[model samples]
Target chain A: MSTEANRLPTATLPGGHLDCTGCTHRTDDWKTGPTATFLGLLLFIVYSTAAAFQGEHYMYENYLSPMYSPVVFTQLERTVTTPEGETLKVAIPGAAPVEHAWFGLKPDAWPEWLPFSPAFLILAFPGAFRFTCYYYRKAYYRSFWANPIGCAVGPFRRGLYRGETHLLLFQNLHRYALYFAIVFIGILYYDAYMGFFRHGEFGVGLGSIVLLLNATFLACYTFGCHSFRHLVGGRLNWFSKSPLAHALWKRASFLNERHMFFAWLSLFWVGFTDFFVRATSMGWIPDISTWG
Target chain B: MAERTFEIWRGDRSGGEFKEYTEEVDEGMVVLDMLHRIQARQANDLSIRWNCKAGKCGSCSMEINGMPRLACMTRMNQLPAEGKIKVQPMKTFPLIKDLVTDVSWNYRQNERIRPFKPPAPDSDGKYRFQQADADRVQEFRKCIECFLCQNTCHVLRDHRKQEHFVGPRFMIRVASLEMHPLDTDDRIPDLKNEFGSGWCNITRCCTEVCPESINITDNGIIPMKERVVDRYYDPVARILRAITGGGKKLPTA
Candidate 1:
């Protein structure tokens, strides 16, 4: 096949760098898609970083942020009152003391030699999970990388591209990261279980509701993962013979369709859950408790 | 008589605009039927391509209302009748004429993939495959080469990473050959280094636009990706490969 013969008869023009000189495929709505994605990711980064560093308010009487689950570093417990006027002490099991600085049961969750936010320790697991996620790869690639910015629009640069074969090889670690993400979901549900206990009695609070919603939304996003879909349903030749697998696959497919929606919703909602816990712990907001 | 308005693209690669045309359309008529009417009645020189008037032939792929789809497969009733139905060439490929694109780029890519290499024959001089194994490859065999998946893919459409990505169509093409039970060649190196399997990112946009409903991303691309990860990235697999002189080899039939 002759390359020249296969070429279209349209007038050719010189391609350029930076300016996208001589490109004719520009459209008016091109900026909207990349702009939205850019702002969304930027907002997430800023808010998540601020909340991660503000170490004082991650845990209140019963509620815990998904960001700081598994209770890796804690000093001790303290007594506090809910907005509903019930007094309860924060006595979470496996909750320990910090050796260094800031808030918690004891003063030193951080050592003199080590100065770091507790959120920093665990945020990377979920952070890496999202950063290496297939959906987020597309999100950041378009929004941050400006790789063409949008369809038919000129890209920022043109060059020899070896896609994900070299420096970006860590993207292949997504399936491995997914295992950690699944384990984190278990950790979060455990936090939700702890939310039901205030002074060893069963009760519901506004924080409890928020934690449950965060867990549910994040679970939806995690379960809807393309990797999860492949593991659960893919590789099988027969859905007919495997009825249980087929049923689970159908449910996964249903969630997969809404993965993008859940991704953004859970992203913002999880951040809000963190903020809610922080504000209430900081005494900026009041938590309404319920006897269930 | 109700007249359906269409803003059909009217030019070639150099420049183009959505030129408006109003035509009488009946219920159950498709966009391709309207295009055929426009060709016969209004613009005799207008260039468009179609075959099988049905959806099976992936030839008549173009953007209708900003989505890559088969012109024949899209029903006239499905689209909002209140506005101008926009018909344009696929943005990813270079435009040849009105509603026609030069999709030879996909053909060039298809040529790069290593074709199926069957295992050595037994005493009977024949290769045998289990029904289950055949069924696995059959899912991918349903691809009609429509290029809708290729056109809709953001890596190709938005990023123009043609140098790095082969789009979703060829991923499954390589997959169909790789997953064949009777095949005995390793294309994993090509998929890793040359074929751009690492670039796919698995958005499933290709699966969404597939008229054949092949799960191009989940079933085909992800499995191929895991294989690439296993061979190249897995630490345990790498150590085992070194000790065992590069893992398991397919048996001669």
Candidate 2:
């Protein structure tokens, strides 16, 4: 069978149809969508990277930054002399003390060359989860990869497109990454719960509310994940017999519809929560609380 | 009543240009109505393919102001109050004449899809799936086959991967069947390889431009991709199937 015979005579317009980026017939402003996505994702990446490496100001009283949740090991509250002979503060203000760390003090095997942050231990799980997300795939593919730039717009690369078939085959592991994400959601909720108690005294603070909302938004995003939707209800062929699965599938479908909304909301709120914790810890903002 | 200008693409596969037509716009005129008036008054030979002018027949699909939309469904009030309403044939397929493209390519693609094959009826000699089961695939049945999704899909529109990808419309068709409780045929291998499911980057232009507002990417294509992953990519699932000698006997391509 001749595949060429199936092809029709394409339009003689400039750039043809596929490469017609500057075609005058296009009346919609196509650049705005991809431009917004590019700037939004770029901002998130930069802010998250700086916050993760800072290692300090991640905790304020009982509130921990979502970036540094499931704190693995913490260093002692003491000043250290740097290689430059400058005094560096090892004790971060408002951070959970070494006693509060799940595994206690930082190990002696810790390399001197590497800067340690609790975020380094756990950020990968959530980061990989988002990177491989079905929604984020669309977001970054259009914005960053310029796969088509916009719906009808021409792409930057003109070569044969492999899409997610080749090197991106690892994207198939998104469901596995989702398991890690679900686990992280549980850890985040625990952190949020810890935020409600300051030194074992039940209390409400601006920081506590911030942490709680962060957990809620992240929960909405994680639960609304496409992979989660498939796992809960999509895999079943017989919804008639499986009443419970059908019910959960319906709920998941509802959230799945708003997955993109929750994705951006959770992303922005997580960054804001980190900033709020950092601000209060650094004495830049006051944490109004019953503990006061 | 108000005067509105339309820049409708005129001509055929040989050549074409946007020919401007100014007409009187009524209170509740749709783009299709304006096109009819223009065809009646100015260019009597002006060509457009439409039926059921109520947007249900899935005809009269064209690029309105650079967005793929059904002309009958797009009201003049919904568009910018000022500016020429640009109307053009769906760019993905070959142009035949003004506002009409050779959409037979879509029909050929449709013919390639395997038809729904439900399992044999029970002892009562009747299908017994609940409404809940039918409701899921019913969303896909809402598709009017406008091929607006095919037009808007960058995989077909920009990348011209029609030889590779089957576009979004057929993906949902396969999803509707695959997710059917009684359907036993397996198209997973074809979905990954021949159908070029991977070609879809999930940019979701198909969902956005869909007149039916189908969640084509999140609900349909992504689920299909996950199934392909389960069959071909998942190592744990493969190991489990190996150890237990348990897995569906997928039909060989």
Which residue runs does candidate 2 get wrong by more than 4 Å?
A: A1-18, A21-24, A77-95, B249-253
Q: Write the per-residue lDDT of candidate 2 for residues B1-253, one digit (tens) a residue.
A: 7899887777787766677788999999999999999999888988999999998999899988878899999999999889877778888888888888888988887888888787789999998877877887888999999999998887788767889999999999989988887788888888988898988889898998989988898888998998888788889867866887855732111
Least well predicted 10-residue stretch by lDDT in candidate 1 chain B: B244-253
Question: What's the CA error at residue B164 for candidate 2, in Å?
Answer: 0.9
Q: What tens digits encode model 1's per-residue C-alpha lDDT throughout A9-66?
A: 3433211111252233332355677689889889989998987665556777778777
Instruction: Report the number of backbone clashes for model 2.
Output: 0
Task: Judging by TM-score against the true structure, name the best candidate.
Answer: 2
Docking class of 2: acceptable
Evaluate model 1 with DockQ and give the value: 0.19
Indicate the TM-score of model 1.
0.75
Clashes of 1: 13
Tens-place lDDT per residue, model 2, A84-160, is 99998765655557766889877879887888888889899999999999999999988998876777666656466
Q: Once superposed on the true structure, which residue ranges of model 1 sit more than 4 Å away at CA? A: A1-40, A74-115, A146-162, A201-206, A209-213, A228-258, A282-292, B4-20, B76-86, B91-97, B117-138, B154-164, B201-205, B240-253
Error of 1 at A146 (Å): 4.1
